[model samples]
Target chain A: MESILQSLISGIVVGSIYALIALGFVLIYKSTAVINFAQGELLMFGAYLCLTLVVVLQVPFWLAFLGTLIAAALLGFFLERLFLRPMIGEPAISIIMLTIGLASLMQGIIHMTWGSETRVYPAIFPVEPLRFGGMVVSQVYLYSVLFAVVCLILFNLFFRYSSSGIAMRAVANDQQAAQSMGISIKKIFAIAWAIAAVVAGVGGILIGNINGVNASLSSFGLKVFPAVILGGLDSIPGAILGGFIIGLLEALSGMYLDPLFEGGSKEVVPFVILVVVLMIKPYGLFGTEEIEKI
Target chain B: MAVKCGVFKTTYRDDEAIWQTKVSKFWLALLLIALLAFPFVFQGSRYLLYVVNSVFIAVIAAIGLNILTGFTGQISLGHGAFMGVGAYCSGYFMTTLGMPFLVCVVAAGCVTAIVGMIFGIPSLRLKGLYLAIATLAAQVILEFVFVRWRGVTGGSQGMLVPPASIGGLTFNSDFKFYFLALAFTILTVMIAKNIVRTKPGRAFMAIRDRYISAEIIGVPLFQYKLISFGISSFYAGVAGSLWGHYIGIITPEHFNVMISIQYLSMIIIGGLGSIHGTIMGAVFMTLLPEVLRVISGLFSGQYPVLVNIFGAIRESVFGLVIILFLIFEPDGLAARWKTIQNYWKLWPFSY
Candidate 1:
């Protein structure tokens, strides 16, 4: 019972980070209808920047975090403008490949700058583990979960209240109709990219806190896909829910299934869920079903 | 005398010929002769022979990718896993079952085709990027299996493949393998050409251009999607089998998302829906890293930072090349080649 409680706490913590990253995917997919394969890379970029500033340059964590967010927003805006803008009217596959190219470019850049070595992130918070009765949680995990929930709430408020947020929703609803109503789809695209990048940046910091920064972190971005797909690619709340569900699945699988399967079941479970979900509910639980005209 | 500048097709037979013009036939014969004689001509150059052999294998894989992504318009990111399936299957068959090289290669391809078809089932409901994601899931799951399935896959340490041999001759040397690779490459290309020109190929194009319309017009979407996957995976299987034998080992890492991306880039930069483009793309992609290495080596002596950053530079440049091609030449190298060919064919009066 204590182990299950511990697992639940850990799962929820990790799930929040996944949720943060999935929000990036949801934001981009909602605005442009293109899945940004580079969201993971973007997360890596944020983590590395934070690392370089806070640890290498010896800047304060909060200052480095702010710098990372700014950089991420700018990166998102420029990426959309430079690479994706040119591919405005291109086929779906081409656009998808462009994002992949961007991901590869980021990976290459990260490898060159940091080398292939994995580095443990500097401790910002106290190293003590937090406990409530029999259950225990690391300070880093607790802080990461708290940070993610706070960000999600703020983002929810932003989307519900901000003018640009409404504009983004309008464009996502129908680009032609949105344009007819005088909404600048280009501006909304840039905003979506920027917002997604910021979210990914926070996710990177949180993940880096737990596991350290490395190329595999980009794959962490990829692991969020099942979450995003489960939640519905375009639904913000869905992304969060998917993240928690996947997080629990991973934790439970690691605890229970790994012993029985002799390991490897934890990694495979999410994809198994992904395939099943894709087959049964491609649009996801919260996703808008696209009605195509022949 | 028949290999002239101008020609006219007088009958359906002449029009339907693989080489429509006598010049094309002569050139093809000459190229075939050149390929057959290449090993003998470059007997001293082991490096060039090795490069050509790898290029041939990559061409086969790229052609398979083209069939699925280019012709069928069903984007797949799990291509490398399919290749891995073929490699592991053939390696297992050759070592455990003691099968002959040719039979193992064909059997490997057949097994991969079945696997591909099963994965392609998702395409019945998903399209475009969603399908790509589904394929990505396939890649991740297969990769996990390759690492964890210790009994059959030999776990993460990987498995060794026996040298391909036939009739008292072993293709262990580059010279021998070049011929083997060339034979398979030629066979694969011929099959690709035939598929593209025939009815099923047409059905693939129709589905790609407009799936709903194609469905309405009586093309079975699910069947054709599976067929495309089957055919593509078959080519990937053959390539993977050849690769396993050539490299003498198989690992899950050997076929990963990176390999899938490289194959996709080949089709994208080589020219989607064009057989010739697959060859061109495969050659370009395979040689690109080598080209970067040479250039970096030249400069690394002068600038020591180049030595440390070469890997990153190469990777970034690869990504940049894909972006440039997507933005500017989405039709790929084949379209450019066509334009040049037309310019030469029309000469001074070129439009």
Candidate 2:
């Protein structure tokens, strides 16, 4: 019982980071209809930037965090303007390939800048774990969960009440309709990308705090694919929900199945679940049904 | 839209010829001669022969990917995993089953084809990026299997493959192996060329262009899609086996998502649905890193830090090249070749 509880607690904590990363994917996919395969790289870059400001340059953690968000936002806007804009009229595969190319480019840049070595983040959160009866949660994990919940609520409020957020939703719904209503679709694209980048930056800071900064952190982007797909590619709530589920699934599998397999099961179980979900519910649990009219 | 040139075809046979013009036939024959004479010409240099052999293997794999993603329009991100299936299967057959070299390679390709078809089943429901993501599952799952199935695969240590021999001729040396690879490369290219001109090839194009419309015209979606997958994986399998034999060892790391991306870039930069493009892309991508190495060597003498930057630059250049092609020349080198050919053919007069 204690082990199960521990796993669940850890899973939720990890899942929160996954949710944040998935939100980066969701925001881009929702507004621009382009899946930013580089979301993980964005997180990685953000972490590196934060590390540079805080560790290398000796800035305050909070100030460095803000700087990271700003830098990430600029990157998102610049990438959309330069690489993605020219690909507006291209085929879906071309656009997808563009994002993939961007991912590779970012990876190369990161590797060169950081020398492919993992760097431990300077301590930000307390080292102590919070105790509740027999359960203990790392301070970093608890803070990460709190950050995710706050982000989710903030995003919800923005989407529901803010004019810009509503405009983004409108563009996602129908580009022509949104344009006709005087909404700048291009501006919306830029804003969506910036927001997504900022979200990814936060996730990166949290993850880098936990796991250290490295080229491998970029793989977290790949891991988030299962989360985004499971929740629904175009749904925000689905991203969060899927992230938690995959996180829990991974933790449980690591605890129970890894010992039996001698390892590797935890890494593969989410993909298995992804395949199964794809087979049974192609659009996912909360995904909008795709209908084509000719 | 037809432009009249000095050359004319008098019969259907002439019109349908793979090399229609006399000049083209001469060039093709000359190229074949050159390939056959290459290893002997560069007898003192094993590295050149080895590089050419690697290019040949990559060409075969690139052509296979083009058939599926470029021709059939079904994007696959799990191509490297399929290659792994071939390499591992062939390795297993050679080491454990003690099968003959030729038999193991063919059997490996067949096994990979079946596995590929199973994965292709998901394509019947998924499309585009969704299908691409689903294929990622295949990549990850197969990678896990390759790592954990230690009893057969030898785990992370990998499995060693003995040099292939036919009758009494052992292809242990780089020069000897070059012939084997070149022969397979020629055969694979010819097969791919023929497939493009056949019924199934046309069906693949029809599906790629418009699946619903193709189905309306009686093209069976599932059958052709699976066939494309099977054929593509078969090529990857054969190429992979050759790679294993060439390296004399096989590991899961050799067939990762990065390799799949490399193959995809080959098709993208080479030109989708163009056989010539596959060859061009494969050779270009295969040689790029080596070229970068030489450049980096020059700069490393000046500043040691430049070495690391150069490495990153090479990778970034790869991404940048693909992006530039997608933006400026989406049709790739094949389209550019056609443009040049047209310019030469229509020379001395503005068409």
Candidate 3:
């Protein structure tokens, strides 16, 4: 029971990181309706940015963290204004391909700048374990979970109460209506991208704390796809909810299911659930039902 | 439009025809003759034959992607996974069951098609980003299965497929293999062309353009989407087998996610919804990296710095190419080619 609880704790910690990345993904998809395959590369860039600020520049932790967020947000806004803006009114496939291209572009640029090598991220949080009720939890893990909860609360408050957040929501709901209401759709897209980048920056730093920073760090973007699908593509709340669900399921499957079928049954479980969920829910748990004007 | 050419009055029907003008007929025939003589024309060079064989195999996959992202208007980033399905499934049959290579190839297509349908079903319900997310999940999960399912997929090491023999005629040579791939590609392209020109093709376009209106007009959205997936996967699967047996080796690395992206980019750059464009897209995209390598060789004059510099520049520029094309030539090279051809054809009298 203790081991299972410990697994659950670790799972939520990891899931929180996934949620952070998925937040960026959902934000982009909700507002722009583009998958932003570059989301992973952006996360990769965020982690690297933090690594550079802390290690290369020797900036303090808080300052470096804040700097990374600002830098990533700017990158997001730049991408939307430069690449996505021109592709407006074009076939949707063109936009998706643009993002995919942006992913490769960012990956190559990062490779050139960082040389595709794994770098040791400077420690911000303590790496000691804390004991509670016969369960030993790592400090970083607890911090990650707490950070996710805090971000979620802040995000909820921002989206629910803030005027800018409400405008973003309106843009997400109806692009035309939002435009007619004097909300600049283009500005909303840029803001949505900026917010996503900031979320991704935080997630990248946290995950870099948990895992080493490298090109593979971007793969976390790929990993978040399952979470987004499960929680719902357009659902901000679902991004947080689904990330935990997937992370816990993965941890449990890796532990318990691994013992079965010669211990490899767990690796494919996330996708199995994804396929099953897509087969049933389709729109996902928190996604809005698509309505046709026929 | 009416045109008078050598005592023949060519109408719009003639202009729209696949084979209308005598020059077109002659050119097409010459193309066929060249294709038939490709193996011998290569001077029996195994390396050249191998490269061409690989290109032909990739064209098969490009065709599949063209159908999905091109025609059906669904984007799939997990195309490599579908190809892997065909490869590993055929690998299992060939190794364990000792099935004939021919049977295994067809079976691979069937298996991949069903996998495509299964994956594609969600596409009927989701649009754009959500569907892409679903496909990405499929890629990761399928890759994990390939890596973890030791008994079936040979784990991460992957399984090998022996070269195929037909009625005691072995295709162990690269030239023979190239011809085999060419044969299949021609047949596949021919059928695909006809399929796209049919009612089913119209249905896919209608769904792509406007789903709700198409449904109101009695187009079965689910059935057509599933069929598109089935056909696309079938092509990808067969290509996998062609690739597997030609090399006499199959590994998980051979069908990674990047391959899917390569195929997607090919169709995107070639021009979606056009079968002929798929060929251009696949050939160019597949050769894009290789061409960079050659350019690297050209600049290696007394210093090796050019190679690495060119390599880095190539990757960086390659990424920008997508964005540039998306912004400027979203219809792709095929559309540009069409416009050029039309411009010349209608020169001196602007429409």
Candidate 4:
């Protein structure tokens, strides 16, 4: 029972980070209707940038964090303008390939700049473990969960009350209607990309704190697919829910199934669930179903 | 469609000829002769033979992927895993069952086709990105199995495959393997070219353009989609089996997500839905790294840093190339080839 509780708490901590990364996916997919396969790369790049700032250049942590977000946002905006803008009306496959190519490009750049070796982030959270009712939680896990929750709440308020956020949502709903209402679709796309990058940056920093930064960190973006798909590709709340579910699933599988399989079940379980989910509910838990007209 | 001024077709059979023009036939025959003479011409260079052999294998795999992604418009990201399935199957058959080389390749292809069909069942319900993600699941699952199933797959350490042999003849050297790869390449290419021009091929195109309309028009969506998956995986399996025998070592590492991406890029860069373009994409993709290697090798002596960073540079160049191609020439090299051909055909007289 204690072990199960431990797994559940840790799962939520991991799930929050997944939610943060999945937020980046939902953002671009919402506004631009293009799934950014490069989200993990963006997260990875952001983490590496922050790492370089702190470890290599010795900048203060908060300053470096802010710098990383700004740089990531600019990178996102630039990528959207240069690569995605031209592919606005192309086939779905082309857009998918474009994002995939973007992912490869970022991966190559990261590999070239940092090499493939894993690099540790200096501990920002207190190293002490927090105990509650026979369960031990790391300070970083607690802080990351807090950070994710705050970010989610802030985004929720932004979408509800902010004018730019409203405009972005309008574009996502109907591009033509939004354009007619004088919302710049191009600006929305850029903003979405930038915001997604910032979100990804935060997720990256969190994950990097927990697991360290490496080229493989880009694969975390791939993991977001199952989460985003489960929650519904276009639904933000669904992404969060899916992220939590997948996180819990992974943690539980690691604890229970790993010994049975002799290991590696955790990595494969989310995808197995993804396949099952796709077969049963292709639109996901909260995703809007697309209707086709003949 | 682009017939010469004087030539005219009198029957559907004449129009449906694979070589539509005398000029085309002549060029094909010349190309074949050149291919046959290639190994002899470069007999001294074992490296060149190795590269060409690998290109042939890539062409087969690329053509397989093109059948699914290009011709049928069903996106699959599990192609590398399918290839791995073929390799392991063939390796197991050869080592444990003591099967003949030709039989093992065919058996491997059949097995992969079934596996591919099983995964493709999701296509009945999913479309576009959803389908792509499903294939990604297949990739991860198959890769996991390849690593964990030690009894058959030898686990992550991988399996050793014996050199291919037919009676007294063994393809132990690159020279011997060259002919084997070449024969399979030509056979598979011809089969693919023919497949694209037939009824099923047209059905694939119809589905790709729009599945609802195709279904309304009496095309069986589920059946054809499964057929596409089957044929594509068969080709992948054959290619993988050949690759296993050629390399004499089959490992999970050879078939990774990156390889699947490479195959996708080949079809994209070569031009989707074009058999000739698939070949072009395969050759270009396979040779790009080799070309990069040669260039970097030349500069390595001058700057030692170039040696250390060559891999990184190649990866970046690969990504850059794909991005540039998607942005500038989305239709791919096949369309460009047509334009060039038309330009030359209408030269001097001009438009």
Computed on alpha carbons, the lDDT of every model, listed in order, comes to: 0.91, 0.90, 0.83, 0.92
Instruction: Report, for all candidates in order, the number of backbone clashes.
Output: 0, 0, 1, 0
- Angstrom error at residue A128, model 3: 3.0
Candidate 4 lDDT by residue in tens digits, B9-106: 89998888988778788999999999999999999999999999999999999999999999999999999999999999999999999999999999
Candidate 2, A196-248: lDDT as tens digits = 98999999998899899998898889989899899999999999999999999
Pick the winner on TM-score between candidates 1 and 3: 1
Q: After superposition, how far is residue A246 of candidate 2 from its true place, in Å?
A: 0.8
lDDT per residue for candidate 4 within A1-294, as digits (tens), equals 989989988889889989999998999999998978899999998899999999999999999999999999999899999999999988878888888888888888788889889999998889999999778889999989999999999999999999999999999999999999999999999999999999999999988999999988988889998899999999999999999999999999999999989999989999999998998989999999988887
Tell me how many residue pairs clash in candidate 3. 1
lDDT string, candidate 2, B167-248, tens digits: 8988999999999998899999999999999999999999999999999999999999999999999998998888998899
Q: Give model 3's TM-score for chain A to 2 decimal places.
A: 0.95
Per-residue lDDT over A1-294 for candidate 1, one digit per residue giving the tens place of the 0 to 100 score: 988888888889889999999998999988898889899999999999999999889999999999999999999999999988888888999998999999889999999888878887888988988778756778998899999999999999888899888888889888999999999999999999999999999999988989998888998778988999899888999999999999999999999989876897878899999999999999999998888975
The candidate scoring highest on DockQ is 4
Candidate 4, residue B17: CA error in Å? 1.4
lDDT of model number 1 = 0.91
Please compute DockQ, using alpha carbons, for every candidate against the native two-chain complex. 0.76, 0.76, 0.52, 0.77
In angstroms, the error of model 4 at B337 is: 0.4
The DockQ assigned to candidate 3 is: 0.52
TM-score, chain B, model 3, is: 0.92
